[model samples]
Target: MNHTPVEGFSKLSKQEKIDWLLQEYLENNQDFKKVLEQYYNEDADLQKLHDEFSENTISNFYMPYGIAPNFLIDGKLLALPMAVEESSVVAAASKSAKFWLNKGGFKTTIINTEKLGHTHFILNVEPHKVLHFFNFKLKKKLLEATEAITKNMRNRGGGILNIKLIDKTADLENYFQLKASFGTADSMGANFINSCLEQFGKTLKEEVSKEESFTEEEKNSLQIVMNILSNFTPNCIVRAEVSCKIEDLKDDSGISNEDFAWKFKQAVTIAEIEPYRATTHNKGVMNGVDAVVIATGNDFRATEACAHAYAAKSGKYKSLTHCTTDNEIFRFWIDLPISVGVVGGLTNLHPLVKFSLSLLGKPSAQELMSILAVSGLAQNFAALRSLITTGIQKGHMKMHLLNILNQLGATEDEKKYFVNYFKDKTVSHHEVIDEFNKMRNL
Candidate 1:
């Protein structure tokens, strides 16, 4: 195959990119072009708005937006919106919500809400001199220098919480950091934290330029490598928990309540001790967390990164959720570092995001943290129950049946018949296709 690069590929118009790609890749381009055009928003203004969310306006890709209801959190019933492509995620969340509804639901609390950022610079001078400079007066000066930038955040009861000097010489020679923490109130504070760090970096340069505490060599040594927000927000944490009597676990799987509780706890223990199991185990938790985060227009990518970092915070990768049974009482809980925003990003722009936030009673950032934590815990609980009892594939395949039928182009009547037919029998792509063929032939 001969390959040649297209000049100015990025600068090309969206349609031009589409046309070029189609021409180079496909024999019949019009059919695929029609497929792309079919998904374009019918409203011109609405389509333009979606296009500005990213560069190179392609057809709007979509995931099913679903509502998992019956989530009773802190004595309030919540209908959570989840935007995910997986067939079983929403169903599993709904099932877990209902299961916990009668068990006093989920109790959640925001432990803290402090976002962090850092200014990395190389200090050719003694580490002690930099530490002393930060400790003596530079810390206050840094905060003061950023007052203009943080004025609005301060007025809203949030601003710089603390500043510290970090010695990272062990990692890289002459490397040091000015670590700062902030309270961003209802916003995720990425921009806020970065703005503050940039200001601090500039101030540090100016302050060292005139400080009599350093020689000419030390004065010229302070060079800022970067100043940016850290996604590993350990201080931004939330805890969500659910508890019930062991005898209260009712299921059709024919397992006794005691056995179910024991097995569930054992499953979690396995995740805690085994790194291989823990990765997928926490991934199931994020399936619920990311869904709700996306629906609410929060930064799920940052949240996922922070959560996985927390999972390994103990020097070994482990489960994000914990399950236990003591004295015939069952308890499931998770304490995770999740940084999310309720007032910025797409919250104001996306119509569906506004509706999703309003549906949750317009929770503040802290309250949203609790809700997100509960979501992950509930998802983990549901998955463990399925894994131990009826096995995960049974329910998962049932949820996947429709997608398979659609792929095979089964008619409405055939779909309805196969849905009921598979209620007792195991479902698979081949089995569904065979049944559909037999029914259509008849």
Candidate 2:
């Protein structure tokens, strides 16, 4: 399938990129071309806006935009929009939502809402001198220097809140970090945080150079490494929990309520003690969190990095969620550093993102953090329940049957027949293809 490379691929217009790629690789496949074109919005203006989101835009890559309804959070009903391609994610979330709807739904609390960034630099000054330079008086000077950069953020009731000097001389020779915390309000504040850090880095170097108390060696030794935001925002924590009497867990799954609680707790316990299991366990949690984050135009990549770092905060990777059963009551919850925002970035730009935000009544960043945490908790519960009882494959494969049918090019009638056929049977891609071929022949 090797083909000659095209020059200036990035410079090509969207249509030209599509034409060249199709002509080079996809021969005589007007059907494939039409399928891609059909996903584009009819509005030219909106299409153009999407095209400019990234370079070399040939077509819009689509994920199934689904809604998981019946989520009761903080006494409010929310139908979360999940943009994902996985088969069982929406189903799992929906099942969890319905199961907990009558059990007081989910409750969320924002413990703290502070984002962090770092101005990494090398300083060979005495430890005391370094500490004194970042003391109360000097910290104010740092903020003063970045006042112009933080003007808009401060006007919006958010800006650089504090700067702390961290000593890392033991870890690396003369290494240090300037940690800055910010109250970004409703924005993710990556750009704002970075801009402030850059200014602080500049201010720190200047302050050192002019300090009569500092030796010439200390001034020359100071070198700015980088200024950036840290996604592992432990201070921006939110807790989401769902609790119900064990007796209330009765469902069609045939498992007793007490047994269900026991098994679910055990599953979570394994994740806590075993890093191997914990990795995949946390991935399942993100399956729910990332979907809602992406749908609402938040940075899922950042959230993923923060969540994983939080899991390993104890020096060992562990589960993000915990389950407890006491006095005939069952409780499942997760505490996650959910640094999400409901404004800025794509939130205000993308039409679907605005609609997603509106669906949740346009929550503040703290509220959104709670919602995202609960989603992860709910998804984990749903997956664990399936894993311990009927087995994960049973429900997952059923949801996956449609993808198999589509892959084999099943018509509407064939799809209906195969869907019913596979409902009472196991599904496999090869089996689906074989049955599809057999049906066509018949």
Candidate 3:
């Protein structure tokens, strides 16, 4: 089986690409080709739009889009759109939302909404000389150079907030940074920030070349390394929290409200201290966050990177969520540094994404940030509640039972029977398979 690289793959048509893949790798399996085409949008325009979203398009990969209803955030009742394939994420989020609804629901605060970009360069000059040049000459020129790029943003009350010169020579030889902060209004503003940074880079080089205060050697020594927006937005912060009287925190697990509150706090405390537990703990939180982010046409990868980095911002990997019981009032909260936009990107392009945004009443970027933070907090609360009470697997495995039955090729009637059978009994793969086999045999 010899496989050789092909040329001009991107030049090929969609059908041609699929044919080449089939002949080269899949042994020309028509069945597999059919599987690929099955997921394509029936409308040609929509399919073409999806294809242009990335390079080397072949087929659209699908995921389950679900809704978790009854979310009360900051005195508003909203249902979140979640695009995830995992079995229990939507269920868990919905359960948590209902549990907290009567207890004043989730309260969120937009702590900050400043996004950052950097123009990194290497300059073998004295720190004071560089700082003097930046302060006296280059900073104003940088802002002036980006006026064209930022006029629209400024009109919307969002634009370049400030730019600072950072000296990083100790960390690396001849390393310096021009850190710029921005407010992007309702958009994520990656392109806007990057455009401004690149212009700043150009202006810095131009200013250095013309300045009489700098020696020719110093001017030539300055090399622009890169200009880009950072995904690690620590300053773009949102806090989501839920609290209730300890006596009101009752559940079907038979644990007393006080006992439940104490145990829940203890579980969160362990996650705060233990890296291993914190990793899984945060993953559960993202399960909810990413789902909504994707459904709303935001960048989930950037959101995840920012969140994980924030969890470790305190010099150790710890939980994003925190718990406290003050004078018999039990409280759980999460402070997330997530930057998401409700406009631009796929928000207007994708049909489902448009529907998702409309479903949320067309929130601003700040409101979306609060929504994401609350979703994550709700997910964490549900997971912690289960862990402290009946255990994580009982409910999770029950949700997972359908997948197992489907794997064993169970019919709808069998699925219904097993669903009822496992209503009281514990669910496991082997046990379900065993019971399924016995039922079929009988």
Candidate 4:
């Protein structure tokens, strides 16, 4: 039976593929469009507000995009995106995910550290005498602030787990951090964390202000150098694993299971010691992970920054995932921060964007991340598959050649011939011209 294709989506036309994507984007992000119109359009006064809050704006605001599908994270299936544009990203992740498809899929857990951070001012008053002050009518500001934080989270059934006030008296440069924890269902908790932070900051200034010395300038300077939320996500976490059987991998290629296992093992090991290789190494992981980020409307920039930062936290770049081949099977695993959320911000506001979020039965950040981690492995597998057999460009360059030809207005037959001719060889503009003339004459 021929199933009807989705509206505005044809399996054929490249433009249709892109159109389908755009349609999905619009359907899910209705609320976001208004926000964008108000805040991000070319002439919005939001920039003025940003300047008032901090001198710098958030960097890399433009999201990179790609999709990872056929994923089951924490036993639930999903289709997600990686908001990055780098090569080998989505491919490697999807490849890796597919490789482990037969394994019990991916299992994940979310640890919701429902904590919000608040800034404490260090006035540089008396070199050694530093104080933590509250802005409240009765000087019960801390309690009020804590109660608000707790109440906000509790309303969501997360309920604040704990609250702590920290003072760094030893270092003048080190001020104070107010840590509060809350719950995020199945995600790493970035959404609630960000909202709570914003709420807490506003609450401190307005709900309680006993002493007026706690000025906006000081608080603004303390919380951010850029008018942006910190990438340090305080929400959910994801832990995932993939298992594959050796028999499933063996096909007509006469490629022994042992050979495939040995090659993949060597590749991962070599990646660990070589930064040159490891950059692509982790990119493989992000290929899967980032796709989930974009599909869900979470901050891909933050996730990317955290992953790269974590990679270099040891002072040298390295892989964030582990892979191994056991008796008659292969297994891969990843544990990374997927603190994205389901019910807030751009995800909820943007109509088209909301559709994207809902595609997965309303997944949490870790559930999303786990699906991505597997996809990342799949993407890695695709790259490796190409490397082992036909070389990476054979399939890629062939498809690219036709894409270029189409851009030049190649007709259906022309596109077909151009693709075939370009296969087993690379063509030049002159060759393209010759093909065009020949096709026109034919």
Best by TM-score: 3
- In the range 316-335, model 3's lDDT, one tens digit per residue, is 99999999999999999999
Off by over 4 Å in 4: 1-69, 72-98, 111-120, 123-143, 163-176, 179-229, 234-236, 245-248, 251-254, 326-329, 422-442
TM-score of each: 0.97, 0.94, 0.99, 0.65
Clashing pairs in 2: none
lDDT of each: 0.91, 0.90, 0.95, 0.56
Mark the regions of model 2 whose C-alpha exceeds 4 Å error after superposition.
Answer: 1-8, 19-38
C-alpha root-mean-square deviation, each candidate:
1.6, 2.2, 1.0, 12.2
Q: How much is the lDDT of residue 33 in candidate 2?
A: 78
lDDT of 3 at 53: 91
Residue 373 of model 4, lDDT score: 52
Q: Choose the strongest candidate by lDDT.
A: 3
Model 4, range 1-442, lDDT digits (tens) per residue? 2333475343335334434444565554545444443444353354444333333332114454666666666666666656654545555555545545556666655444332444444333222222434322422444455565457555656754554545654665645544555555444455555565555555444532333554554444443211123455424445566666766666334677777767766777777778898898787667666666666666677778767776676688877666688787676655565445666656665544567766766655545555555555556656666666556665555545655676778778878777777766755666777778887885
What does candidate 1's lDDT look like per residue over 282-384, in tens digits? 9999999999999999988899999999999989999999988988899999998998899988899888899999999999999899889988998898899
Residue 417 in model 3: lDDT: 99
Clashing pairs in 3: none
Model 3: lDDT to the true structure: 0.95
On a 0 to 100 scale, what is the lDDT of residue 349 in model 1? 86
